[model samples]
Target: MRVERLVPLALPRGQKLQCELCRGPAGLRCGACCVTYYCEVEHQKADWDSIHEKICQLLIPLRTPLPFYNSDKERNHGLEQQLSREKHLVELTHRVAQKFLFEGKHKEAIPAALHSLRFSIHIYGLNSVELVPPYLILAEASIGLGHLTQAEEYLSQAQWTVLKTSHCSDAIQSKLHRNLGLLYAAKGNFEESLYHLANDIYFASCAFGTNNISSSGGYYHMANVFFRQNKMDIADSLYSEATDIWHSYFSGLIDVQLQTIMSPSEIDILCLPALRFHSMELNTIFIPSADESQQAEASQILNAILDIREHASRQQPMKTGKVVHALAMLHYLILDIPKAHELAMKALLIISYLQKQDSAEAIQQLINLIKSKPFYAK
Candidate 1:
């Protein structure tokens, strides 16, 4: 944890320096060089020249410290430590973008998504399923910004990366399939989308179990394809199925605190399919208000898990736009029109800068929405 404990760049040769902590042999060699482990000054003086001397100036700043993996437990711990930071940043970025998208402020989320993508590259590498998430976020933001072509381009890039990787983790593959299906759906290739989504569902079922939260996402996405095509009955059925999966998952994880299982963000992810399904049921296709009760229940569960306030607070600059957007929409839904307007405008500004690759419908919708709003009156 302390970079200072590391071998310093400037150390004289041959003086018998050894770390008091890990007991690792010190690289420095000087009679004055000494390493000690203590907090109080009294202890320092006693060990002065014995160990304290070498420890005094070995410290330096390290922006990206490689995980210290001297043992299996250490390696796992180190990875967990590194993963914690990265996950925090990624979650923050994703929340912002999600906020933007939910609020119909797609344009603003683009930049934040792009920045998140860089971190993702570091974590998942270029040709892994992990790339799918950041790419999909970017593509969606592009669509919001009226850069349909750019959205498509990023989606294609993600798909290519997924396919190219030989041994993708099941989680990654499921996510990739779900995203690809969504991409194809956006392009009006319903059948193609369905095919990919089916694959996503299959993989998800295997990865997370048939009744797992991960499986729900693919089912929910496939339902979107049917809904968009005006196959309301089929869409409704699929939505119901997805909801069942979520309900089962909720039952499974309900007693476990968010942090206890994986992390808060991971738990949030576990609930995402239900949240998304609720969104679809509420807005997209014309489902009777008779199901309003179900929507409310779903909303309550999703809200408790998603916790937009936390998501927004932790969001990174790379993903600030999207979090803002999602928050704006939630505000709008609650009748906080002013906040919604502000978020929508920010999303537009960001979207204007991205390439429109794969989302003609989304792009046009954003444009039309903005033009209709009083904020664009000037």
Candidate 2:
């Protein structure tokens, strides 16, 4: 599996380089893109195949320092070229970082995020409001990796930038507050987290209407905080609201897609496959808990997500496997080991068939979890 790919920063000479995939002491570098380092030949090959091939040449400009221009006209033209290139690089790295973060690959996200940060600094100066987005990305990635202190530093910087700006816009404020909320939650400061999350929701609702899909993420995060605090009623209400927003957004696409489809097999394939269950067996092994209602609500939301992803994945088998894997994780979260294992195996089958090494590794981890636990087997 490909590991974290840290872009080289200004460091002391003789410092050991980290591998692009493993973060081990790396001695080998990619011949095509010397900027990428690896601990071994196999890791180098894996990184190249997974992501580097597409970005190799694009990263070349970052490695090259801006040329010196003595003439005023030449300096102006050179700065213009630098700005255009930096903008493109920033967008590319930021998009890649967001994708990794979405897939829960936090370690892998850091390098791309750092690259985005570097380019953003070049394009907009060190303390510009435009740099807030990149800082937020780094903060979220750090939070995902459980680096709370580092996350705090990034969020603090973002907050300072927004505070200094005369008109930072509600959209940016919403995102900044959302990251602050997440950071506080990770630090176990529930009260502070909720306060920030409330601000996040308020600003998001102000920027985008209350019913907009963009505000759904704030609702979802706030719901999680409530769920952790055992405020089930509030959590359930928020979850329903968030899912309802998502369902409406996705259902619109689904309806439009359905109208153009004429094939019965295509429609049939979109229907989620039924999991085999022995009710009597499950009842004997699993006892109902007071939180069963919450679990049921969670299951309902996961099913709705699966349905939406199923239709969306008609042309993307890998996404189907990803959603199945997510469904397995949800079951595991709700303490349904047998069902989690079954769904995991199903996900593994789909991903393995598609020959996705990273996804297959994730499925294998879920299988390992099933084996390591003491849950009753069906």
Candidate 3:
């Protein structure tokens, strides 16, 4: 719930504020853009040659009044073309915002995103779907910067806008609820957090059933609420569901991790894996059984599944590590020590990598679970 501070530029190691020029320090402000920054004036000036020149060009519209864009059909045509060209510029702003978010530069991201959103609105119009993400981004940035009331207000506006026409996409809804849940949870409003989380979970479940990444995210956050409540049984169940969904969701997307820029329904998705790993230390692992013959048969089938999973993990689009993790858990439950060890190690590697690189709570949870391997330690 506590949003960490943004890392400074020129720092040895940190999150979003890395200097673009040196990739060490945080940005301060560009005299031209008046928004982007550098560790120092020198870096800002040096970067002007490569990055800042283009960014300055992108800022041209922002500097001009809104009336110019609407100056007439011919001018509008030129403005429209210019806006189209700057589409990528907006993307760059979002990327910069992401770095800020990662480095706990939440405050910076809000303003940066605000600037970009304003430009986006001028180009795409306020009602355009393009504006939705920036609104959501600012809302989340507000949450990170401990501006919960502002966060809620921004999110509410975005939700109303999206729902005005069609129900917002499951992805957006999942995020909306997830953001609300995080804000409420941070405020110690567990009941409100739970309410939003529950809705998120339901949506995530539907998404999961249909193999939708958004819905699976819902289940993940749902598990978190349960975990916080110390309802281990329910939490574990939801965790299992979430792990499976994450595995499935990311199965086809290699090295493309689900970012921790979470929504209301997604905290649990990220947290559930971590919780499950914690639960493993209690010596309460479950294994399916029928008979000796059936166990062997099931183990054979599991091996086949494991092979498919491994193959998938190797491919670019299908990162099957989660599948490997679940399989490893199942292998352990079935008392297949060798298989469990292998798959567990594989899962541990993937989860560890994700945690290290992305700082996802779910992966961290899995790593903790691996570290507390009482059964395997001996």
Candidate 4:
């Protein structure tokens, strides 16, 4: 019997990602996933003869031109054509994005993920389990690009989306929390990371059973976080536990059912972006009259956005400081005088790091906007 899938294939390691068999420095890769490498045609052919042929047809390509779904009049119902288009668009787009991400081409992956995010929201809606995979992929890609705050938002959305569906298994829930833990760790918030990691361990244990080898992955990560925090005793114990689990599995009591499944990022096609708003409608705000509560709510939203901008300044100071400063003016316009002053101060803090003249001008203009207010007349 042949292997039923071409994916989840592991590549041999070298200075570069290497050939599966020869272990030679290689460049030519399998077109399907762009992962498997070959030193020469002979080695490639040999590998295929040995194992690849069994699973080749089951493999999804890393990237491909978008597939057009044909729905002529005979098969076209009101929504049939629309669903067909959405399915092909989302699936193919996801594949392309995953390819970029796997290759560590983070800059290239970002746009692909952004495009898929929009498609996921439209195709799966807010409540579907289908939304979790792309949301997690977008989060991972965002993390790769050092967009920690964007990653946090994506993780939150993933959690919310998962909660909206009862179909998600404990393993998936564990996976989501694991990413959250990792995200918080990246942001230098180890407390949140440990909490999430612990939850991941718990859920994974529940899903895979206490003695299953697959549950050790969660133990390994949790140990890793503890190791990072310099809690040697705890880390040592967790590491030992993971080792014991693996040793037991190597002794041949492993459960095939407990192995991790291929996530959506691994197998699906890409997603096409869906337009959320009309260009004209976005430019026009309909809230002409605001009550006191509305004003307070708006100020709260501005505050959260300000926090994101401040964090963003660390990565893209010139661009973010300008936006933060402008948002400060908006804060003042909304009569949130204190918040506006804080936002202005935060932007100015970033300005000390910016080397651009235009960025300085934008910050100055933001200052002028705040100072022109009667409250700042002194």
Candidate 5:
């Protein structure tokens, strides 16, 4: 229920806040972009030539008043090409907000999220449900920074907006419930967290099929709640359901894997795997214990699922690792967690790497398309 923070370390090792120019201990900020820090005026000025110039360009629009992007202004080409300067600025701000959120730069995310929310009101009325996504992002950043009260306020506004909407999408409803669940979880209100999480799962199930991977995420979070309560049996059941959904979702994607001859001894577990879970999640979280019976059960479960897993692995090692990893996590709930944690981590690396590869490929394709376009200048 608690939102986990596993932001990858971005700055150079051994130091996080160093002068971009001189690599010195730093506190001074660049006046234009207000993103980079420097140790001295000299270092800040030096960066002006190499980095600040480009950064300042991106931040320039923020200085001007952000106006409403009237959707009514679409041109002959399309809405994308017809965006007014104000509309473009809002889009840019929204992108920056999301990027900051993804990078764990919560402080920076706040202003961008605020800008997006403010501008969104012009497009959709102030009380419109369309404002919820930005509001949710603001709440997420606030929670990341431990601003619990501020986060609550944001969620409250969003909840009110959602109530006012006569027609809200399941996706939006799911997100709203998910954030409420996580917020209550962070506040140590387990019962409230459970309620919101249950609602989130219900809506997500409606939007995405019951066996879809996204719905499995809802199941995973609910499992975490059960695990936190020390309800090992229920937690294990939830974990099993989540993994089964994941396995089912990926089963049809790898025909080559299905066709390949799989050795029973080298069976792979097929599914999607997640990393960056909190130690308090309980499912894969470690605690010390040595039980021969627990170990025996773990072994038996793996053996029993081997044929099924091998069938999945012959097509995609990435997916198989995830399925096995998810199963290992269920063991962590009912058996010795430390061992299961190890297996989960190993599987996580494989799937997470593949995920990155898929993302990078997509970005590269976009870049190629952009470059391939014919450019015309005024």
Candidate 6:
């Protein structure tokens, strides 16, 4: 019933030991395992609580050097061990990178993504189609961190690999296009972004059904582009489609959870979907002039997202803060100054706790907006 451990250590030769959490130079090591290093006791305890406890013993096998082989039989055994280790290392590191990226922890994802890319090259060689997934992960993490040039480099590598392969799967094509779309969008090339996003939608629909949740991301990103362009009607329709896809998926999950007595850990699985739905629904609320009925519906959906987050075990502060900040924006738009200010302050506290200085700017701006009102001046 326990969650599986993932790859944690992938140190380079001649490099000094680094903290498992922050990647800073380290003098401390886990006493029990003595394999993983940390910059300080605090980071050590944090890593232990986050992942090391699950992976401590597992690190021993990965860290131990392979034996020298004398006979042919011994050589074959060593080769087999090497292959096994590389495969495990690539798969686990790739998954860990994906998990961090999904949680919006871009900085945290980079090390795991780099580790995955290294081991993937060891397993499948540099230009193999199998390397595409790790390249895509690195590209995504780079995009999230605003390193567009680095992301473009990784995406170009992926594109080259796909071109070299005789037959690439629709799934990989879909992901490649999605990242391309994201990169172009970040670069403010909306035309190119939309073209790539359209291809992303097509490939995703071809691989998974049109109604599949996997295809919803393309729709969501496309909506964001239209929304930014002030094309409210088109944005609203696209947002609706994305929201419906997520709503249907989460509705099923909520039903299952309601039927069974799920532990806190089990309930944690719903957090990501809830956050995704919250984002789409929040966008829908921004499509300008809404009737009272529409406003009521938006409130209901936002409250449901909060309820799901409330029950989750992890309580992801970064994501939760964004949700609260969005609600503050919604209240401000509706001219509910008091409610907006209260929620904005609450979101600021959460953002500050996570030490996200950039994220707090929007919340501070919202507070400034609330204070600038003529009614408040009196």
Candidate 5 matches the true fold with a TM-score of 0.49
**C-alpha lDDT of all candidate models, in order:** 0.53, 0.69, 0.56, 0.57, 0.57, 0.69
- Arranged by TM-score with the best first, the candidates are 2, 6, 5, 3, 1, 4
Of 3 and 5, which scores higher on lDDT?
A: 5
Screening candidate 2 with a backbone cut-off below 3 angstroms (N, C-alpha, C), the clashing residue pairs are 3-21
Candidate 3 ranges beyond 4 A from true positions? 1-57, 60-77, 95-108, 124-130, 163-168, 201-209, 250-378
After superposition, candidate 1 runs with Cα above 4 Å error: 1-105, 122-130, 144-146, 251-378
Q: Between candidates 3 and 4, which one is better according to TM-score?
A: 3
Regions of model 6 farther than 4 Å from truth: 1-57, 68-82, 252-378
Candidate 1 accuracy as lDDT: 0.53
Q: 2 or 4, which is superior by TM-score?
A: 2
- The CA lDDT at 200 in model 2 is 88
Candidate 6 residue-wise lDDT, 205-261, digit = tens = 899878776677788789888878978677656765665665454334333423343
Q: Estimate each model's TM-score.
A: 0.44, 0.59, 0.49, 0.41, 0.49, 0.56
Residue-wise lDDT of candidate 4 within 280-360, one digit each (tens)? 212221222323222333333334334543453235465455446655655554555577678778777887776666555
97 Cα displacement, candidate 4 (Å): 5.9
lDDT of 3: 0.56
lDDT tens string, model 2, 1-378? 234444456545667787766688986777776667888877777556434666787767666666888899998998787678778878777777666665666776676776677778877788799888878988998999899899989988998999999999898999898899999888889899989888988888899888676676677788778878978677656765666665454334323433433245544322322101211222221212533433343454556545644654234456556656766765654567888889889989988888888778756755654544545484
**Better lDDT candidate (1, 4):** 4
As for model 4, its CA RMSD to the true structure in angstroms is: 26.5
Worst 10 residues of 6 by lDDT: 278-287
How well is each residue in 67-117 modelled by candidate 1, as lDDT tens digits?
556799887877786677766656556555555554555655554565467
Model 1 misses residue 46 by how many Å? 55
